[model samples]
Target: MSPRSCWIGSALAVVALAGCNNVSNEMVKMPPPAVTVAQPVEREIVHQLEFTGNTRATEAVDVRARVNGYLQKIDFEDGADVQAGDVLFVIEPAPFEAALDAAKAAQQKAEATLALANADLARTQPLVQRGASTEQELDVKKADVATAAADVASAKAALTQAELNLSYTQVKSPISGRVSRHMVDIGNLVQAEQTTLTRVEAFDPIHAYFAISESDVVELMAKSPGTSAASLKANPPTIYVGLTGEKGYPHEGKLDFAEAGIDPQSGTQMRRGIFPNADKLLVPGMFVRVRLPVGSPAPGLMVPDRAIGMDQSGEYVLVVNEKDTVERRSVKLGLRVNGMRVVNEGLEVGEWIVINGLQRARPGAPVKPERTTEIVEAKQLDASNDPAIANSGAQLSTTTPAKASATGGN
Candidate 1:
């Protein structure tokens, strides 16, 4: 090797060694992650299950024509409230009146004939006993009397039928309710037992029908052993109902009816609830929200839904320990009351849980946690989450019982 090149390489190695010695290994401390935390709320809570249902009338009646006649008059206004036995329509009474009169005349004639025949039989009996008439003649006279008596009875029945037809000419509301519009106008020919003049539905008490899944039914039956859907029909459970667009269940009702069995097509069992609608606020066929209590009141712990998290292990929540270190806790969950998810296990009532900035939390890491009495501040879905699932269950339920409803029975 050339002496100049060896000297240059040696100089470069000495410089690199000096640079390496000058550098020192040191670790920079990163700041603890800032987060919000809250203690869980403990309360005696029962599972409130809500289901979509439809309102029904307690008693719905289709006022139909009872006798064939021309509609003569409409006595009640369309959609007016009516009492039981209130006249709503008037068919032409002329024909029925004439028929009834004819029947009465025929009955009178039969009565006169029966009286004459009775006198003749009395005379024949005396004559037969005294041998003033032949036995065959007396027998013939007795038969005549019997025939006349039968005619009189038949005529009386005809008269009663005629009177009934005349009475039916004035059609009356058979139920107390708001009447529907007239189906047939004045002078329209209506057939007996064939035409529906209008309809009436009882309004004081309304009904709501709903369905529940088989799993829910099983859970409910387990909580109250020996309870069956049929037994519930006899003595209903407490329930609540709400109309569409209502914020919460505003109407109270009772669960009175349940289908004999579950519907195979939908895997749900039909149930019914009855609500007092004295104010006439409820209508038939309206969609309603029904809420039912699945379990008796028991102590339970709840946390903000946002604080709950999921991982390969299962659902978890970040809890802050005494040292304010973030700890991942696996928890068993119950039904959501609203925004709050009930923690059945793995969480204590007083434990601090991370309510916000979950991304910043990691197990065993120290964190800057701000504690507040308000456990779950109502929160919306974050933008980074998948849109489809991001909006799902974002808000936490405020502290309240879950709303529910069901059907009604007699």
Candidate 2:
């Protein structure tokens, strides 16, 4: 009886131990962590290149005195709008008037001398023909007449020069534009073609200059050969200029010119646009942003910033597979518009991605997805939802576990 009882008890104990081990293993096996997944969304995307540039007036001019004299009057007010040929200053004309009078008197005296010489020549010709005067006398009288005619021509030229000088006494603007402050005020002596009296800047149809990368120029030219630098003057590209802190483009401009060669130092091509500043709002040396349409818009895919993850390798996003499992996906990015990113590759539309609870998520782990809006509501309901974590999770921050998983998965 004792041998039979001992054997049965040992066998039962061994079976029970084996059963307990199986139960322990079963209890330790836990399901994958719950994660929310999202689908790759489809939307229209626009590719754009944003660059910082400056505004400049298309043309600028400086007004100066052509003749030297004391400025008797200022015809234009400082900072006043003026037209081409508008009087800007008036120099003292007294000296110029005296010169004109002297030139006219000299001209009249020369004319009188020419008339007397002609009379003498005529009289000598008759005498020579009648044999009353020597041929040498006739020749001398004819020479006198020719000299008098030359004197008359010289006097006439002097008179014309005097008139021109007199006209120059009233300094007129060379171009239509806004007149700057007078460099030389009234009663100040200015030199001829040497001293700059003031400046006149053309505001209407002003110019804006900007630079584009050499690569961009090459791409653009490849797409449209007609838009090369050589043909820019005849058929220039259109440009739009917008001021900082302003809404839309205030002025539309046309490409006027481009540099013949790329700038070696910057590796950029300089381009110019002409804009109409009829309102006088645009000025030279003003900083402005320029927009140029280089290519046609194409349809593409995009995702929110929260879905992208970045690490040493590059940018990527989390993709939920058909089995409702998370898989890290490496992506090629194109442009950033608003807060969204253009997905150049590595993602297809309508694929789910984990957007929330990413801090606790890992690659290939099972996820329990809640709508993004639901997550927001839950965070609002539970004050303990650490807004920072919720926001980070919402944004799929790279430092978070889900982002690490994406990086690891990649």
Backbone clashes in each candidate structure, one number apiece?
14, 12
- Of candidate 1, the 10-residue stretch with the lowest lDDT total is 401-410
Candidate 2 residue runs with Cα over 4 Å from true position: 1-51, 247-250, 304-341, 352-410
TM-score of each: 0.76, 0.72
Q: Per-residue lDDT tens digits of candidate 2, residues 116-231?
A: 99999988898898999999999899899999999999999999999999999999998888888989878778899888989888867877788889888887787655557788
Stretches off by above 4 angstroms in model 1 are: 1-33, 233-235, 264-266, 305-318, 321-333, 356-366, 375-410
lDDT of each: 0.80, 0.72
Q: Which candidate has the highest lDDT of all?
A: 1
What TM-score, to 2 decimals, does candidate 1 have?
A: 0.76
